[model samples]
Target: MTDIQFDDRVAIVTGAGSGLGRGYALELARRGAKVVVNDLGGSPSGVGASASAAQRVVQEITDAGGEAVASTDSVATRAGGAAIVQTALDTWGKVDVLISNAGFLRNNRFEDLTDEEIDPIVDVHLKGAFYVGQPAYRAMRAGGYGRILFTGSSSGAFGHAWQANYAASKAGMIGLSNAVAIEGSAYGIQSNVLLPNALSRLEEVMTPGYMEIPAFAEALQSTDFSFADGRMTPEFTVPLAVYLVSEACTATQGIYSSNSGRYSRVRLAEAEGWVSPAGTTPPAVEDIGANFEEISELRDFSLPAHNYDEFTIAAKVARARGIHS
Candidate 1:
């Protein structure tokens, strides 16, 4: 395969101080994009901030002969988000790609998850993506060229224990990207979501005791990006990201799962079911049971663009059944 190169593109990557964000920053730099390295430089729990993490990644890129500037901005706030995009404009003129990789993990059972625990994760993971993407999205709409990527997780789309907060936040991103993709199509902006399964500080947050295990220690030192239980190195997830954000990508509103070199798209769909006329009274309990098989049929369906699409489908069903004029 021919090497994918960024050439004159400019990119903004959040949470670039370490882990998956670091890998994305380095890869984008190596591919010839001028990068804005953004990191709150906070701990995995989003407790405090520092500049060291962002600075180190910027240094790594610069030392390796790639162009980059460091910005310490919290994606949770509007002002901070605007400042991050401004950093790219001031340094490189415009933003062509955005990798919303900044995130944290805090795990607790559903009953034990408090407001403090849930709020920050939602703010950082979901709201943060909105904060940064809005300005860059506007810039892209004006320029008529941009790639926006939102980070999602398997936990929410699939399932995981002790991750209710994290899962819900990530799931929101899928809906966000779909809206962006639909609206941005005319302007040459492509928005997509990535559900990454990787090993990083975020993973460490989920399983704190793993580091102290001798077997885990030995495995970490010798592992070569294997997914023997679905554990993947951060490096394993970057190639797909690079492609998605590159100029070659024309696909949008797609959700992909990547890990250990395995990649696949996730589809959200609907099932065709029984329908009734709008003015009809509610059906009796026995009537519902009589139509159970029809309600569960999956032979045909409509993929509604939004919540209101259900109404349109209902109208069509009524017309087909001669219940409506």
Candidate 2:
């Protein structure tokens, strides 16, 4: 197969100062993309900022003979998001790809989380994607070409202890990507979510003892997995991300996960549910309780592409039961 190249494409990667975001920025630049490396240079806990973080990445790209510019803008606010995109537009005239990867962790147990803790996590991860995505999406709609990738997390999709805020924020990215994918379909723009399990600064801060956990340790030692220095590094996850944000990737509304060398699709599926028989009095609570197993069974499941698809499935079942809307 021929190599995929960015060439004249302009890409924006938020939180590009370090970790996963930095890995993405560097790879995109290396592949011929004119990149806007946006980083607030904030601490892992979302406190403090400096220009050096973004500047260093930009300098690295330039030194490697790639085109890039630095934007030290926070993605947590609307103005900041717009400024980041504007930097890309002013520098390259158009944004062909967007990787909404800016975020910091503020992990806490559900009960212990205060507004102070919860708000910033939502602001930077969930709302931040929205803020940066909307403007870039608009630009893409006008140009009639774009690829968008939002950073999601297994903590949100599956579940993890003591990371309620982080999980909620990351999970929200799936919904955001779904909306953008549906809306942008007519404009030739695609949006997808990525759940990456890589060792990054944010992960380090959020799970200080992760390596000590038996499951993590065993996974690290597994022959089935591949890693650098016994850890899943951000670079290991970058290839998938780069492909998802490249023009060659035409899939939209996809949720994919990458850990170590394993890559897979994560989907939301609905089981074929029990429906009340026609001509029978409406099922009672007792009836529902008796049929609970059938209702919850996972056999013959279907993945709904959107809300209407659920209704379509319900209508089919209802019709089969001799009921009409």
**Which candidate ranks first by lDDT, i.e. highest?**
2
What is the per-residue lDDT of model 2 for residues 1-325, given as tens digits with 9 covering 90 to 100?
8788999999999999999999999999999999999999999999999999999999999999999999998999999999999998998799999999998887666787999999999999999998999899989998999999999999999877668899989889888899899999999999999999888787557654444557756765674543445559898899999999988887899999998767899998998788876765899999999999999999878889998899899878778667745
lDDT of 1 by residue, 90-155 (tens): 887888999998989888877889999999999999999999999999888878899999999988
> For each candidate, what is the lDDT?
0.88, 0.90
Model 2, residue 257: distance off in Å is 0.4
Residue pairs with backbone atoms closer than 3 Å in model 1 (clashes)? none
Superposed model 1: Cα runs more than 4 Å off: 207-231, 277-279, 289-302, 305-325
Regions of model 2 farther than 4 Å from truth: 207-231, 279-282, 318-325
* Cα-based RMSD of candidate 2: 3.1
Q: Count backbone clashes in candidate 2.
A: 0
Q: List the pairs of residues colliding in candidate 2.
A: none
Give the least accurate 10-residue stretch of model 1, judged by summed lDDT.
207-216
Candidate 2: worst-modelled 10 consecutive residues by lDDT: 222-231
